[model samples]
Target: MSLRLFNPRVISRAALPSTSRTFIPSIRRLQDSSSDAPANPKLESIVDQIASLNLVEAADLAQLLKTKLNIQDVAMPAVAAAPAASADAAAEAEEDKPKEKTIFSVKLESIDQTAKAKVIKEVKALNPTMNLVEAKKFVESAPQVLKEGLTKEDAEKLQKALEAAGAKIVLE
Candidate 1:
């Protein structure tokens, strides 16, 4: 079992090469020693000072700089950061987007007999120009549309109001 642990293929102690290899400096070190040297000490100090500032102080400094430089806020154009295939897939997904309902019609399907009076009052309240008798007649009519071509918000509001008054309403 101990002999199995020591493999003959594995060389435990390898002899070093007779000749030493020459050291070659990296391209970055070579470039650093050339014309492209370190940044200006004053600029680096300013950057270090800015980095030390807290969030609010940094924001105030940024605002001051913007005002001093008369810099106007300009929105940057949106760039698609996805790969070509992903961008094509995204465009196809956008093209396959479902149509959203904007305008809706509020229909009064029916009103409970017991809540007829309450429903009538709500209908009259909904339309202030309608008299009580007209509103009552409107409420009596079954499966009649109350309001048409209304926005989603208005339709939802009317639906809630009528439902609360014990009326069956549908928004189409």
Candidate 2:
């Protein structure tokens, strides 16, 4: 419950192999704490005493305390196993669920009589390989697929652009 601060004179080189350079003159010096001390003076004393001890002394103290308190070293695998099990269950759930449709087709359903020119221009812009005349012909041929095997996002974008240009379009 309390940390016993070791006296350098009493605890010589033969006592414990402490490579710590921390030095406090006497027990009275620790008892007369500075203004920096927290609400709990006992905690400050324990902290100061622990700070003075080296690695070996601290490890020895921890091991002795663990044994005395009957504390067991629990394996990390027990805690980690839960997430891994849930991940496996999630993978299985995905496998059981229906597969999503990614591929789509953009179809030109119809064109407004007044916006025929605009629709032709949009078609030409969408297809760089096609000439002006060919794009015009492509526009005239309504209810035809503009592009096939496109991703859903690409199909939707194409549909929106054509619809904006006064062409009735549908994504399949």
Candidate 3:
């Protein structure tokens, strides 16, 4: 059966026999590749020349050359191991430290009186147990519609009527 890249499943269902392809490299291919290594003739000659320099000259050159070249730098894998191990050990050590807990308490009281009672009832209906000053403020700030929703003249009459009965009204 023919191979169709997009429909490989159809080929499998067709039950075609499989073929074994063997791969083998010739002698010419084996002889073609060479190892890669750098040959720095200039650096080698400089090292040889430095070794021949007198002690005083070498000391002066060494002082001048601080950090200019590093011949035996440590590999990163070796350098990184110590810090990682120490960090792990530090985390383990910190878990053993004792922790402290804190708690608190509060007390509250309610007061009752007459002129304040009406105000308290209104305030409590809107929001429970409002402070005395807040209740007074609420009464003072209440709207006209809320207070009575009457004309100026009618409001005056109502106020007079309420006063006659020893009552006070606050408008929204």
Candidate 1 residue spans exceeding 4 A from truth: 1-95
- How would you encode candidate 1's per-residue C-alpha lDDT over 1-172 as one tens digit per residue? 3554556446333432333112123544677768757888999999999999999999999899999999987897556675787778888998899879899989999998999999999999988999999998888877888889999998998999899999999988
Task: Name the regions of candidate 3 deviating beyond 4 angstroms.
Answer: 1-38, 45-78, 82-84, 92-172
Global Cα lDDT for candidate 2? 0.85
Each candidate's lDDT (Cα)? Answer: 0.84, 0.85, 0.50
- The better candidate by TM-score, 2 or 3, is 2
Worst 10 residues of 2 by lDDT: 19-28
Best by TM-score: 1
lDDT tens digits, residues 1-172, model 2?
9999987678764465444323334444577665465558788799889999899999988899889999988765445658988788889999999998899989999999899999999999989999999998888988789999999888888888888889999888
Q: TM-score of model 3 relative to the true fold?
A: 0.19
Query: Sorted by lDDT, highest first, which candidate order results?
Result: 2, 1, 3
Q: Compare the candidates by lDDT and give the number of the best one.
A: 2
lDDT of 3 by residue, 49-99 (tens): 998999999987876676666544445553565898878887888887764
Better of 1 and 2 by TM-score: 1
**Clash count of each predicted structure:** 0, 0, 4
Provide the lDDT at 88 for model 1.
Answer: 88
| Clash count, predicted structure 1 | 0
Instruction: Estimate candidate 1's alpha-carbon lDDT, on a 0 to 1 scale.
Output: 0.84
Q: List the residue pairs that clash in candidate 1.
A: none
